[model samples]
Target: MSSTLLEVTRAAHEEVERLERIIVKDLQNEPATNKDRLFQSHRVRNMIETIMSTTHKLVEIYEDKDSARKDEIAALGGQTATGTNVFSAFYDRLKEIREYHRRHPAARVVDANEEHEALLKEEPVIEFTGEEAFGKYLDMHELYNQFINSKFGVPIEYSAYLDVFSQPHSIPRKLKLTRQYREYMENLLEHLIYFFQRTEPLQDLDRIFSKVTAEFEEQWENDNVQGWEKDVKESGQLPPQHTVIDLDYYSTVEELMEVGPDKLKEALVALGLKSGGTLQQRAERLFLTKDTPLEKLDKKHFAKRSHGSEQNGGAPALKEVDNSKEIALMEAKMKKLCDLLSETIVQTKENVVKKQALTYDEMEAEREEEEMQADTESDDEEQQIYNPLKLPMGWDGKPIPYWLYKLHGLGQEFKCEICGNYSYWGRRAFERHFKEWRHQHGMRCLGIPNTKNFNEITSIEEAKELWKKIQERQGLNKWRPDLEEEYEDREGNIYNKKTYTDLQRQGLI
Candidate 1:
């Protein structure tokens, strides 16, 4: 499509030049009538030149407008047509000009009427030397630099190589997406090299060139195979094969493509592989037979004959038996073995019978004995009921029956210092009473510190009152401090060697 358009554009230029030649010829053939004729000839030449220049300029502008329209459409998130107000204004102006011309008729004079004027005004001609033209193109070149910098994060000079050397001046028409885009990629390589020389890590530029060239070729071909614009519109993302690795891994073609043959070898070595044997070979050697080196048979088959052998067809092998005198010896051994077996059988039977019978006998004996013991205990308890000992301490220090003492395990020997007769229970009961009022008062009267008292508690209220008094008098607070600290310390020391040794010796620590 572009080639055809270029051909048409070239033909149009030729036709315009041909038409200019015909007009110049017609003007030159006119009768030369002194000053007027000379002036008319000059004007005709000027008009022809003006028309040619203006026509070319208009073509350039329209082409640029078309390109800008496409760009605007693309930039506005891909609408099909550009929605530029300039196009509407141009259309309205074109209509007005055509209407004015149609309404106001002029004399039919060939290249002589001043009223039928040329649409173009004379433009200032900038006479550019080679350097200036190069500079003009360089303006485009710099844009290429900016483009490469923006798109691929490369600098302009580095991206200028292609423009400077590969194909100078005549930028490829295919890449001329727009006037900007045409120069943009054309000078990409050169500008890229410019920036890379200063900012780049050490690398062979030629290798980078080769890789990039290959990439460009690939991308170009891909765009051809799958239309670049269509692919972008159809897919929200770039295609899978279009992926480029980041800077860190973009060292070589292989690395960029992730075809890590060298790395695979290194990985195999890291996996403890030495020889270049295939995985299948390794697995076969590890899991399969190990007979002869060639056959690699298993060891289990050595003790048994192989199947389908005539001599050992159905059965493998049977043990050999002796005859005559050896048989008589075997008979004697059998008799001894049978006798031992009989003894073992008898012992097993006896063990089972004993196990079963012993539990039944024990249960029966325990029942009879428990009944006798219960009767005996009842007789003894009745005797003790009438012969109760006197309790020295009671709730009010009155004499109490010894039965409570027997059950409570507290008597005169267990009397609290604070409340002497009040202590008549176990250690826990004594400790409870110690935290009571009577026990506190008795200890104080006896010149013994209240701390020495125990078992004077007759009620929960008395225990609380004594505890509060002790806390106030002795500055003691926090119950079970000793027990708590002992527990914490012992728990902390459990992992110590001495603690472990003591635990092992005592079967507990």
Candidate 2:
């Protein structure tokens, strides 16, 4: 009896997964002194990888030839072996791509319908009604009131529409409250996904996340974890702090900010001020509130969640909206995309976030890629010899020219204080980094505007002084209505507002 092709494929896939796992988990790390085993894992892994690659290549070539032959036959008005219509199938597949994009508007379909110019030129049909599209906008007027109300004991911090979006399977079916004790920051991340997507902050965040991922992976490699992704969650907790930020302890807000955004935010939270903003904003908020009476500090920031009724005996405010199925379906797709984004935050053991395939078909294709190829690449990298100096890799996967590296001053490292002391390799990278997201982000946190005037001013103190001087100069130049503007009196005498008022009061006009 012969096994079906699908059954054979499934068996082969399972065997591949098992073999790869054993090679990685069992044999890969055997000590070099184990002469009995002779450390044959590398050789065994390489040999298996070669066989897999060759087999897959041969199979692909055969399939390609077979498909081309059938296409040729169909194009020449002949029948295919399996009675398949290749020409029709090709266009049908293209149409399927078009239809998929139409159904899932937010899936980020790129190079879409670009297989043919005529199809690409065709405008996509707009399905959402004008009223529906208009209605979809967030009602800020009502939303702020809901936030102020903090309805259903949900803390306002994690109650935003976008925050609700990223938590998975949260649309169309119906909304449900978990009511589990989360300190408004149940998750490590407190900001919106949009904030995390910002370049500078993302880079800053990447460092924090990279450290966390490394530690988790090390634990996983040691067989301390049962599943791969159970620990892929954010802590949202601030970095550890030593002391309370105080006016007596620190002379300037710049001095107070030496503790970093984490500490600054903690101080802001303690002071009952808005804790969200760049590092600079938090420090400023803390310093400004230092002299204020405790009662004057924002109470809204720490407002307790209300149940069915507000403490004032007012019922929770509601914004009534009539939803159409089309709008609901659109929202469902959007919610699914958001859910998938949070679901697919896997790290590749390197510090990089693994790029997720955007569509189901692409994801299926990615899953089908041979696992051995990755192992083979890793093995090949280990076996190859390289430069002793450990220079940067070039576009062709070799150490870049030593002179080119020297010319660019790549050997030297520059650290930007504004960028949380993130180091940039080479003078070009260092200079360029000042203008990039990380440095600019650091500046933004300090409440300093990123401009040429502040360029190369990485010292927080210097930035504060320059910002103060700029503000002073701006104030001097600013038009004062009472002093600067001249008013013509009935006697044809031009007088400033103060002079004109004095003359009118004295009856001297």
Candidate 3:
């Protein structure tokens, strides 16, 4: 239909242009005789006026049709006539309505019998004019202002109607200044304001919304905490205490119980526990301890005398008591320190549990548990000697081998020459030994930095080379200022040569 209208408009335009050309040509070709030229000129002017009137009418008609089409498309909830497939458009709308109904089933029914029944009372009709009309517009503006302010908890002005009024097409063709026309304009303005509000971008609104939401959330949390405390008091139950380690172990145990003995055995074996004997035995070995009374155990008794008397093979003598007050004070201080540490641990555990509750997800929980279990198993296996060449078939039908142990020469007797001839076997045992305080002390004794990278350099030659490279990189052989040059007048104050010289030249120095 639009295409047909466009074709008719094109034809009308062409006809108008043709008439204009003909009128121009006639005026140009007129005879030079005064009377004939005058008559022909008058005729050409009349033709030109008629063509102009016709073109204006055609344009008006085209504009009216275009506006009507735009209205029709808008009424049908379509953006463009050419782009809209009637069937598909209606189908999508229907689907959307169906989905809305599915989500909120109550909106499917319309209640028109009781509450929405025709009211016996007639609504008041108020007319505004002059100042009163202007006052009513102010009232409407105030209402819009209040609506935005109250809804968003922020002040926002409605100026979209101003733009609508500025548009030429917004005014009807047969516009009037009557009461009905004024009412129509008011309604149109109201609609425009609503449309703008509904379609406005929320980028500017985010900060205000976030602040309001945060305040509400904080209040909600406070309320929840109060309610929880109340419930706890009413129930006469203590609040639960939870730690990160406790939660992890609890989850692991729960999963193991759910998966049964077969999986439990597998988990234990993976943890480097002997998988021999029954599943019950493996479970006991992993989770239980032997019950023994203190009285039943073989205990060693120490004499109340000093060992020096025993070594001299002499009769035990009583030692003189000294510094009893100082000893008592030290003991009290130690006790207070222990108490503080325990309190700190409890608070830290509570904080961790609270944080975990906020961010925890069930899927992520499972994945974390798996990773933790793998790490635990790896740590356990890393302490034991294992042959990487003989790989065991994993539960997943893949080869589960200690490849790192073989690669790092951990299965054999390993020694770090830089660490002063210490032999280590097993992956973790060797790595840990290499990174120990004693090993670091040994490296320091050798006048080298105790970096972990040196642990990989097992041979003396490689260690020497690494130490030499480190020394060169650190510029240990570079020229440096003496103590006097580094520190001028101030005791225990060190500086670069230039800074020291500058300070020394100053009168204060």
TM-score of each: 0.17, 0.23, 0.17
Worst 10 residues of 1 by lDDT: 316-325
Best by TM-score: 2
Tens digit per residue, CA lDDT, model 1, 1-509: 11233444565665566556655554555544433343444455555666677578548845765575345434334333545466565566467667766876783435632323341222223333342231122212444445555423345343243233222213222222233443443344344343333222233455755554565456444544112323322112222232221223344333422534443333222222331445443333222221223123443322223323225643421211112122222222323322323443344345445545676436544554555455556745434322123334457433444344445665434554335455444655665666667666765664445453334444444555777677688665555533443322455652444445556688765
Model 3 regions more than 4 Å off = 1-411, 476-509
- Residue 295 in model 3: shift from native, Å? 99
Candidate with more favorable, higher TM-score: 2 or 3: 2
Error of 2 at 490 (Å): 6.9
TM-score of 2: 0.23
Q: Which stretches of candidate 1 lie over 4 Å from their true place?
A: 1-124, 127-131, 134-138, 156-241, 244-509
CA lDDT for candidate 1 = 0.41
Cα lDDT tens digits for candidate 3, 128-175: 333223112222344344333331112433443222222322222112
- lDDT scores in order: 0.41, 0.49, 0.45
